[model samples]
Target: MPDESKLPISELQPDQIVQAAITSHQPWGITANLIAYESVGASLDVIRRGSEPGVKALAMNLPPVGTTIDLAIGALRSWHYEPWVWVDLTCP
Candidate 1:
């Protein structure tokens, strides 16, 4: 299997938010609110899966929501599977 840790950061680009409804697992029925950040903060709601193209593309796209003014607040306060792992979600 490919080493996820070795994946080059450059491979990930055009960052955007995706709303993924957890289909399975303990959090089934829950929604995964994902945020992709560049230098500034931007937010979008995922609407449907496979609507886009890419890893995060598997996640559905939704309406553009509030701009993440506070990184710490948005992340820490939101319900995430693993917030620490999310650090890479926004990183380049």
Candidate 2:
């Protein structure tokens, strides 16, 4: 296995699927700590596969905190001191 702590998001393959543990919920989405990339987290702003633009995704159906789920990489964004990952749900 690769050293997760040293892995960079830029090195990930396109549309790669990864595991992440749910951390918390926000009004916009859920926060999850990634398993393949230690110290890295993803912001699942768009939970559904075909959610329309401007439509709000409901967190009621999302996994609860501590649950590990598979997600597909959407993009890499920088919001603060480090690069943040944006992911899409890989399963229903």
Candidate 3:
């Protein structure tokens, strides 16, 4: 990865904020996956994951994620699998 420590902050607009990767989260257990806005002192996030990349892409593109777009969040497991005989629900 690039040198995050040296990431620039000069281009930020008057009303905008810089996207950041939070390297610290002690008891909470959250990590670098979380993005933050240092100017606004808040973290950025999406409500839910879409079925495909398109819906998610559109959401970010409409307002843009900025130069730090390279830093994106994703799920560890995007899908699930089970044997056909398996059943999550059954008659008592």
Per-candidate Cα lDDT values, in order, are 0.27, 0.62, 0.29
Q: Please write out the lDDT profile of model 3 over residues 4-78, one tens digit for every residue.
A: 554232333333332334443333221232233222122223223333354355344433233232233222221
Clashing pairs in 1: 45-62, 46-60, 46-61, 46-62, 47-60, 47-61, 47-62, 48-60, 48-61
User: Poorest 10 consecutive residues of model 3 by lDDT?
Assistant: 83-92
Q: Candidate 2's residue-wise lDDT over 1-92, tens digit each?
A: 86746666666554677787889987767788777564555767744533643223334477789999876666655555554444443333
Off by over 4 Å in 1: 3-15, 19-21, 24-92
Best by TM-score: 2
Enumerate clash totals for all models, in the order shown.
9, 0, 0
lDDT of 1 by residue, 1-92 (tens): 64444433233334333322222222111123333412222222223222334324323322133322221112322324533232212211
- By TM-score rank, best first, the candidates go 2, 3, 1
Off by over 4 Å in 3: 1-10, 14-19, 23-40, 48-92
Comparing 1 and 3 by TM-score, which wins?
3
In terms of lDDT, model 3 sits at 0.29
Task: Write down the TM-score for model 1.
Answer: 0.18
Residue 7 miss distance in model 2 (angstroms): 3.4
